[model samples]
Target: MKKHIKTINGVDYLGHNALANNKIIHIKTTPSSSGKTHFYWNKGRAELIVGSKVHFPVPSIAHLERYRESFFDVGRNEIQIGDSIVWFFGKPIQPMVCATVVGARRDKGKRFLRLQPNHPDSIVPETWALYQPGNFFLVSNNRINRHRAPANIIYAAYQDELNKIEEIYAPIRTRRIILRYLTNGNLSMGEKAFKECHYELFKSIYSWAGQYRKIELVIGDRQFPTMHPSKVEKAMREFCQDFSNRYLRLVGNDRAKMLNALVYAHKELAWIHPFEDGNGRTMRLYLELVAKTRGYGFDLAASLNSKKKKRYYHFAVRKAVEGFPRILTALLNKALT
Candidate 1:
């Protein structure tokens, strides 16, 4: 054998080995400190080097890359709260499950992640687990079957929308613009501001970004029903009128009453599901602008990808689709600052 090279997780390492013979070899054990096992071909035999130790001739190079992407040395700082991850079971890597990273901490210099199963039926030993390289992987490149989009793609879309919001709608100016229409009782102007959020966020991706959905819309795996295509315009008009009346009536000293009105408007607009896509994103942005007009912070628009927020949002949106606003109202109460 001459010089051997290996690549793992986009990093390459080189090693020189002279076996004076020629036969292919492989190994099937835990990788060394370098996270890769080197193969040195010789005459009818090969060397299997794991760390400073060597095991004899074994398997094949095809199996070397089997779990290559699974053993990334993710830094503790790289893992953020509310990130999605997947954990593998025992040997052979079967029975893998998806989970959300809810918390993080260090105990005695060892990092740990607080995980919650994405599926309620999933069985996990503990909420906290050691941050080991081979035990779990972030869900960035994994393709979701339902939307057929990678998790990283979904996160990128959210980040793009957030960046646009900050660019086009600075908080003070956004608050001024929204309150102008609200205080003047100009529902048309308010609706334009509402739809503009969708246009600004998705005009490049969807031609119909600012328009109402012309086709029937369904939400989530449960197939939550949105308003019929024919009724969307009328529903939105009625919603705007109702929201205008309530906002004017409740914009006084009672912050609690104002929050209730804002929550009601949010749930009603979600029920309408005006746009073909990005209803949730648009609604949250619109809600934030409205909240800013009332002296509340734009918290919901920024953290839409949070796992806990996703859980709460799905539950609240389900109730909204079913024409029940209580759950969504409660969710908004918690979200609005």
Candidate 2:
């Protein structure tokens, strides 16, 4: 029989992986005076009124030991206090899907994974603390071992957003490395290349660079509920393989089809939002590859964020959600020609 999901005080923690999206609802497992053990998740993004039983550890898993392989490989290294992890929701028959690790709590020698707050870890990791709990509350990427905040940072409490610094051109350093790798001729631009590109672009900024986003997010008003974190890798791989195979083989004056393909490519990247950050810039970079193959270039408008243009861009992206690409096609058509 399948393993029963772990719970504290009869609260079902493992419902769906998406439930742990951006808030690492870190709960403390405690023993009560009546000789019973109960849980209180009164820290991090979700503060459960001290004695309420309303949360999960890694979401959808009653216990982590049942699927030992998925939690970490054999002889797992010291899982750093704040390192990101992929939690497996071992669905029967259906292939297992993953959730991002956001927080962790130690209970008798086991590091129970805490998922990224349904949202957190924005441009700055410091901003993520409010969404996470426990000693995993961090400084930049390193988890703070001290119970209190750093002496230098203001409001360095357990639940404050990190300070924002200038946009330090994280892209320039990453762009250089990716360009060198791409020009090597042996690499066919596909999902692997996309992964490589994402890694090179943001590894300097965050450790979990190439991996998929750990939580689900909405771009505009639409939630896109079905687009959960676990499905990110599969969707991206399929897209990369299919698009590369076709685009690479096409020859002759297929400009119309090529532009349409460009629209499709852009739409797919935006639709997925695969990486944590740089999805927009990454989409453009990927489009540039598609263009490079066709002996031309694709450029996203610098002023694309202006009210007039962002509205249309957002509308086109939303339309792509429903598989309608005419408006988006026109936009790409203009950029390519």
Candidate 3:
């Protein structure tokens, strides 16, 4: 039988992964008798209140164990403070089980509560923290730790990259580039290869580059090439014109609307495969620019990968050909959110 966990009188504290149709879970905890609560996560520390829910997933047995140790694991199954309850599950536990009030303790100058159904006692503390949700472990596991850089080093690198772009470009465009770089690190150019290219120049004219070259571009696992050079040029021109017109209509001069327009416009442009080589890179960059213009920030590089790429590309194609923006919208929403 599969074991699942749930929490009562608590809020979700994090979101961990997007695998398996948004494989997400939550960290829910109760307040002290005085009604004070603490929030623990990798980014953006916040205060917890009654009735607040933060949903996230615990990815594996090891991750669950780590969470137990970090929060509770005070050499007991049940930990209580005031009127609140904290529970932990073991190897017999499954993703569906909700932990109840178990136990509490203080270690290394911090206080934590423990839950129940204790597994082996050999689980390490480092692994214990890996179980909390909200893209933290996956991002750290895949990129941060894989790169073997210290936390400060990683932050510095990201800040440096942001600074380089900010020095050379407008804030809006800089923000976009930052978002894209955060999401995916790779960038490609079709034929327009030059250093220090202005964001506007690339935005306005990159689609038309290499249009005269009679080549084909195919994405995902489709049986046919999605676009041929000759067809792409004509389609792109029409797409751009129509997109600009739509931008004016749907958003009607609102900056946020304009940014959303830009995202959709880039999505449409990507569908056209207007350039031979750099469509993917350009589309991502374009999306970043739009997002920055709208006061939104995201990390695309940290989210997408070779394993997820195939599904993403397939969704894009489906959006373009089937007149179904659901898949495309879902992807962009995921990125933006």
Using TM-score, give the best candidate's number. Answer: 1
Sort the predicted structures by TM-score, highest score first: 1, 2, 3
What RMSD value applies to candidate 2? 17.8
Error of 2 at 196 (Å): 2.2
Candidate 2 or 3, higher lDDT? 2
Q: Give one digit per residue, the lDDT tens place, for model 2 in 168-219.
A: 2334654575566557778677787787766665554356767888788665
Cα lDDT of all candidates, in order?
0.55, 0.49, 0.38
Candidate 2, TM-score vs. the true structure? 0.48
lDDT of 1 at 65: 27
Q: Give a tens-digit lDDT track for model 1, residues 216-274.
A: 98776777787899999888888887787867366666767767777777778878889
Q: Which stretches of candidate 1 lie over 4 Å from their true place?
A: 1-139, 143-189, 301-305, 321-323
Per-residue lDDT, model 3, residue 163, is: 26
Task: Give the lDDT of residue 321 in candidate 2.
Answer: 60
TM-score of each: 0.51, 0.48, 0.35
The local lDDT score (0 to 100) that residue 26 gets in candidate 3 is: 26
